[model samples]
Target: MRSNIPWLRTIEQFEDEAIASTAVRLAPMGRIDTDTLLSLHLGMTDQSVSTIASRADAIAELAALGSFDHAKLSKGAWRMFKDRIEFLGCVLPVGWLVPERRRLAPGQMASAGENARVKNTWLLSGLICDVETGETLLDRCPACLNLLAWRNLPNIWSCQVCKLDLRSVTPRQSPPEAVAAVRELARYLLKRDIRLPAPLGDLPSPDVLKFSAWLSYFRWLPEDLGLAISPKNVPAGFLLLKRWPTCFDEIVLKRMKASTAEDLAKGDVISRIKAAGTLSSSVARLPSAAAQAIVKSRLETLFGFLDGSSEGFQDVMVPISELVNSRF
Candidate 1:
């Protein structure tokens, strides 16, 4: 064992150098997508297909474990790769990795800083509608309903006028009638995607849209559970509800069944509304109570126009009373 020490040390030293060089190349890239890896070029040399495949497999294997511990995860991956793979050296130069895509995120890439505003506006849409003004209100002292300016109210957590903590201020909630109207508008927009404005063509991906919608709508439940939600987040709360068949309670379900001939028609609004609410800022920004009242009035008129009978109109209106008690 003593005689073999020198030989073992030499092998270890070489391996350490190889690992360090390999790490340097990959560190900046963070994680490479499959297609990008296939055609990867470093300086004047192109990476071998076999080398990329092995690296991809190793990364996939580590990801499969779903662990948050970086040290433990890396160690495990290293052990598995020790026998089969060797990190000879990086095939690419550092210069090749420096690109605009790495520096500017998807949201940052959006023209005129619209990405952050879009998300913020979506999160604040319900509150905007709740206000009688029908305009986007970013910073208002919730306790006194005094408009707060960025120059005066530098500290967001505290209210300038009321001197009360902003988090403690309860938001003015829109009526259920307003919420249903917003949902109906969301449904209409999704069904007519061809009519969507040119500016909103770059909406978030499907999964992100679903998550944002969920967050916007369901934020109220946490507030109900004694969470200190700021009044500014009130619009986010309204945005959380999605139009699933199960989202509505028994009464609304019965009403929908009587009105629509098919179960597919009943579930249609639920499936479509998620996409609608996520993509269109205009739909989200519609005046809450005002929009609902408009929708209700239009719907009543249309129903009357289609069926002149008072009995037929009464059947739909009767179910809408149950709309006030809707859960979705």
Candidate 2:
């Protein structure tokens, strides 16, 4: 065991995996993935562990390996990584978007200051950008389109598969509004005192922001809406903006109504309710009665839009009504 171990202090904006991964590299552990390193050193079986206690234990164990048993880790090390949120595992070097005056040698990787540090919020929200520089974070290799998360490379600034220096690539221009949207989200994630803008602020809890991001980025909502600025064009985090709730609601309601109507038209009462049931399940975490009522009203109005028939409306609304009742 190396007594003079170069343990990198955790940057406040670095995600747990990023911190762990960089620590492994500085430990000269030779390219081991974060989970394997944790399992080998700490006997941790759960790769999804993100609790402060768990992270503190990991720091203590890692320090022990370096013969520093009494080393103290800061509480700030574990503050930003939330266990409830799933890992996006994406990273962007701090200066990736800014063009360098001098090009890198064929194999040289980019570094921000001394080392690359990814933003903590980007790991959660999958919004790739450093807001201050107005630069988008590159999560994919420009040469091969290989995802950054696909391989646990020793250097985060180089693509493992293609050996491409990410700093050498030209970046796409992110929209100003899109960057602003992501900036707001990152601010909210970092500081609890900072309230999210309107409509998003109307949400019951900040946890819902993750749900909304999922719906906007990964779910079928974008396709259904035929959004002018597709999720691909801008950061998916932009869809969580204060201006987007009405558009999101309209599309979701439209989708639910269309899906329900199609099933009802086939005279499948069970299928129609099943479709509505899925929607209800997705929004069950919404705690506001007013929000629930709005969803219910929109769902109920689906009947009015469908051939002006009231029959079977109650049947379709059963799941939604139950959701509302349960929440209230």
Candidate 3:
């Protein structure tokens, strides 16, 4: 990689020292959302649609059922590998590097210059079990990184691990009021543009508070996905995010819906979820519909501010462009 991009180089020094340290300490593990993991095995890792998008298509097409070492790379991708490395600041690693038990993001890896510290596919597989109703889907396990399965486990009742006795059970945990609150909060967050009025610490029941968190979770996806999964006024052709096969199980939903001792307000949901109160602790630990809400809120703010500033600058520049053109 070129070492002459002044802004890029300067920003590296400006990055938080602790963040870099934490990044280095965990870069080996790479970025795996632990909250999204369920069960896993060892094989050729990196199989998500996201990965496919990130990789050039020829590479993806040539990928056979068991081809690993010598990847079929088109000339374009090979050259891109060079250009990518220049931009990416690292070599394209050729083998399975055992993953260290650390969690770091791709951005962090770029900043820290630490490639796979170890080799472990943070993946899941098999029927995506509904966390609440035990409904199995042709989905992957949220805990482990693996491709989802549907046909093999038609009536499998027991968990692959810990023999937790996951099977057909009466699904009676959803509360009507709780669902309403969850749906409203989700809709609000899905389109949250301006700062929301501070939650007036006046919500009812702990269940209601959880519904708030679920709202936050639904907003984390891209806008289209957000619309599809939004609770209130979901678009005409969109399905609720709860039906999403990529990133949910009834278990997580149940936890989001489960009520606590007191119904906290909106702000409380953020503080409590971040602080992780007892009931909050269980549901807030990982990516829930709620945690996603928080992330969405933050990103929306960040992007909103950025987009606004960009628009304003462009508006200001319009007259200058016109004046310059007049001289010409």
> Which candidate gets the maximum TM-score versus the true structure?
2
Report the Cα lDDT for candidate 3: 0.26
Clashing pairs in 2: 128-137
Candidate 3, which ten residues in sequence have the lowest lDDT sum?
118-127
Cα lDDT, model 3, residue 187 = 38
Q: Give the RMSD in angstroms, all C-alphas superposed, for model 1.
A: 21.6
So what's the TM-score on candidate 3? Answer: 0.20
Poorly placed runs, candidate 1 (over 4 Å): 1-119, 122-139, 186-328
Q: Predictions ranked by TM-score, top down?
A: 2, 1, 3
TM-score of 2: 0.51
- lDDT, residue 144, candidate 2: 92
Cα lDDT of model 1 by residue, 65-165, tens digit:
22223333232122113112211121111221111101111112123121111111122222333223232323455468665422222222344467655
lDDT of each: 0.29, 0.45, 0.26
Name model 2 segments beyond 4 Å from true: 1-17, 28-54, 63-83, 86-113, 150-152, 194-207, 214-294, 297-328
Q: Pick the candidate with the highest lDDT.
A: 2
